[model samples]
Target chain A: AQSVTQPDIHITVSEGASLELRCNYSYGATPYLFWYVQSPGQGLQLLLKYFSGDTLVQGIKGFEAEFKRSQSSFNLRKPSVHWSDAAEYFCAVGPLRAGNMLTFGGGTRLMVKP
Target chain B: DTAVSQTPKYLVTQMGNDKSIKCEQNLGHDTMYWYKQDSKKFLKIMFSYNNKELIINETVPNRFSPKSPDKAHLNLHINSLELGDSAVYFCASSQSNEQFFGPGTRLTVL
Candidate 1:
């Protein structure tokens, strides 16, 4: 079965500290990976996606993810954390041509201490 | 304008009743989808419509039916709702690989 896994359910970081959220996927073929952020009471917003080429993918809100095919991981990273960056982050995997119905991870909640 | 939108931000209904949630997208995308987020916060795809044609239908109960009047709208109707049906339903639209999601409708069945 195709699935995305976020090993960390919650993480706390101080404001201005660097942050990283781990994501791993299980799939048969080359995966199309995505990172989405969901604020409280809000919908899921796409941060970045990795389709093909360039293993390093840049996303909105100063977020970036690197697709490591050998390890089956696409971890989200940021050099600095802000108070406003506190939210739930989900990693997803989908096929390219398939209507792109995403298989999302359980999500990682980030708490920023100001 | 909103890219994807769902009516009834919150729906509170009793079990054994019927309800429908409407979703519309103004992005002129060819594909539309419905997803359900359970109490545990696991999101799963329920249905997908592309250009008024059913493209993907996950393993969901038949009591839940999705109807797409046109390419821009897809509505979900639940018959004989149950307590387990209480969850957040999200509608999304997509052109290629990127999907734009709506604000989501929270359904509470008591």
Candidate 2:
């Protein structure tokens, strides 16, 4: 079965500091990877997605993710974190079949410290 | 306007109750999906309908049924709901590539 793994359960970073969230997926083919963020009492919003072509993909809210096939990882990175960036982040791998449903990782909670 | 919307944002009911949650997408997309988010925030796909055809049906229970009236609406109906059915339900739509999600409906069983 295909699965997505978010190694970090929770991460705390000071405001304006650089941040990185690690994600690894287990799948046979080159998978469609995505990063989604959910604020408290809000829906999941797409951060970025990687399908093909460039390994580095940019997304909304100044977030980006790099799809590394060799490492089987798609890690999200932001140069500077803001207080508003505190939320739960999820890494998902889209099934390649026709339906193409997403297999999400156990989310990672981000804590922004002032 | 909300791209994708699900009615009854919060539902509290007893076990064995029958209930339905409605979903509508105004994004002009032909595909819609239902996903369940557990207490641990782990999301799993339940059902998907594209252009009024049932497409993806995960290992969901038979008690749960999805009805898509047209291309833009897909509703979820649960019969004799169990305790395990308590979770946040999300409605989503997709066009050529990207998928759009709605504010989830949180269901609690007492």
Candidate 3:
């Protein structure tokens, strides 16, 4: 079974500050990885995805994540986060099969301080 | 345009009651899924349908039943809802790797 672990339950950062959200997965084969963001009272939105490609992938809202195969990690980073960036972020892992079930992390709630 | 949409964004009912949530996707995807998100923000897949055929059915309770009238629609019906059923249910569709999600239906059982 593929599982995603987001070690950070909650993170606080000042507006315009850089941010990084840690995500680690437990899967035997090279699984597909994804980052999703859910705003307050909204559904989850795909931030980015990593299949078999470059180690680093860019996503919406100036977000990027690097897939470290050796470490079994895919960490999301943003150079500067706006206040609107405050939301719950989830890390998900799935098999290469399309429309398959995805195992999502516990989700990290980000808080932005003015 | 709403690629995916769920009806009755909020559902509030008493225990032992039955309720249903409807989902529709305009993306013309052949696969649709149902997911449950607990208050703790933990998401888990409940059911998946491909071309109106049941594919993945997780260890969800039998009280929860999913119906796929077509490839673009998947509806979830819960019987004898309990307090534990008070969670947000999300509907998603995917033609390939990436899935598009509906706004979600927040169910509250009193």
Candidate 4:
């Protein structure tokens, strides 16, 4: 079955430190991958997406992700962690065909330390 | 201006009651979808509509029905709500690959 996995249920990083959140996907064909973040009491906002070309995709809030086909991974990375960066991050694989549906991972909660 | 919006940001109702959540997208997208987030924060797709036509329907229960009046509007109606039905419902629309999501509706069953 097609699925997305976020191994870390929770992560902590000190302010000004670099951070990386892992994501893995299981799919039969070339998949469309996406990263989204949700703050407390807020809706999810699209951080970035990987469709076709350019394995390394840049996103808002200084976030980026690289799509590694061999490992079936599309991990999100940030050079510096900020207090505001602490939130729930989700990785998703979608639409396999059409209809714009998405299958999301369980999500990883980020807790930033001072 | 909000690209995607949902009404009744919070809904609290007793079990066995029927309720509906409305979603609208101003992005001029042709595809719309409904997703459910459980207490565990696991998000799952429940339905998808393209051009107001049902395209994908997951293993959702019959009590949960989605109606799309147009390409930009989709509404979810639930009948005989149960405790397990309590969750956060999110509506999203897509023009191509990237999807825009609404603020989400938090439903609580008593």
Candidate 5:
């Protein structure tokens, strides 16, 4: 079965510091990887997605993710974290043959400190 | 304008009651989906419809049924609501790969 794993349950980062959220997946074939963020009491918004070609994909809100096929990882990164960036991040993987339905990870809660 | 929208932002109901949550997307996407986020915040796919046809149905209970009157609308009806059914439900639409999500409906079964 295909699955996504977000190893970090919660991450605390000081405002203005760089941040990285780890994600790993298990799939039979090359998968469509995505990163989504959910703010407090808000629905999820797509951060970035990786399909083919480009290994590093930039997304909205100054976020970027790199898809590494060797490690089966699609980690999200930000150069500088803002206070408003505190939210729960989810990494998902959808098989190429599975249409658009995604298998999401548990999620990583980010807490930004002043 | 909202790309995808769900009705009843918050719902509080008693066990054994039946309720419905409506969803509509203005993006003109051919595919729509229903996802449930439990108290633990585990988001899982429940059902998916492509152009008003059922494409994917997970291990969801039979009490929960999805109706897609059209490609732009997909509604979920739950019967005999149980306490365990309390969770946030999200509606999403997609053209091909990337999906747009709605604000979500928080359901609380007392």
Candidate 6:
């Protein structure tokens, strides 16, 4: 079975500092990868997705993720972080077109430090 | 307008009581889904419906049942809810791949 792993359970970064969230996936074939952010008491918002083509994919909220096939990793990156960026981040991997059912990783809670 | 909306954003009930979460999507998408987010913030897919047909049913408990009245509505009914069912439930809709999610309904079972 396919699965997603987010190693960092919690990450604290200073405001304006660069941020990176690591995501690894175990799948038999090329996978569909996604990053979602959930604010307190709110639904999750899609940050970025990696399907095919360019290894680097840009997403909303000034975020980007790189898909490394060999590494089996799709890590989210932002050049500068803001206080509002603090939230629970989830990484998911699943079928690209079928039911689009996704298996999500244990979320990484991001805390912004002033 | 809300693309995906869920009724009763906050539900509090007893352990043995039953509850239902209603979801509607105005996006006119054929696929809808139900997801559970545990206290620790871990999320898992519970059920999915496409055009009023059951498409994906995860290994969720039988007490948790899902019904799709039409392409736009998917409702989850939990019978004899347990304390462990206290978590945030999210409804989502998809057209092709990208899914739009609702604000989420937080259920509290005391």
Candidate 2 lDDT at A16 equals 97
Model 2 gets an lDDT of: 0.93
Pairs of residues clashing in candidate 3:
none
Cα lDDT of model 3 by residue, B1-110, tens digit: 99999999999999999999999999999999999999999999999999999999998999999999889899999999999999999999999988889999999999
Which numbered prediction scores highest in DockQ against the true structure?
3
Candidate of highest TM-score: 3
Off by over 4 Å in 6: none
* Superposed model 1: Cα runs more than 4 Å off: none
Give the distance in Å from residue A7's predicted Cα in candidate 5 to where it truly belongs.
0.3
Rank order (by DockQ, best first):
3, 6, 1, 4, 5, 2
Give, for candidate 3 chain A, the lowest lDDT window spanning 10 residues.
A94-103
TM-score on B-chain, cand. 1:
0.98
Give, for candidate 6 chain A, the lowest lDDT window spanning 10 residues: A94-103
CA-lDDT, candidates in order: 0.94, 0.93, 0.95, 0.94, 0.95, 0.93
Q: After superposition, how far is residue A66 of candidate 1 from its true place, in Å?
A: 0.5
In candidate 2, what are the lDDT values of residues A6-54, reduced to their tens digit?
Answer: 9999999999999999999999898989999999988999999988999
- Please state the CAPRI-style docking class of candidate 6: medium
For model 5, name the residue pairs that clash: none
Model 4 share of native interface contacts: 0.69
Please tell me how candidate 1 rates in CAPRI terms: medium
Clashing residue pairs, candidate 2? none
lDDT of 4 by residue, B31-100 (tens): 9999999999999999999999998899899999999988989999999999999999999999887889
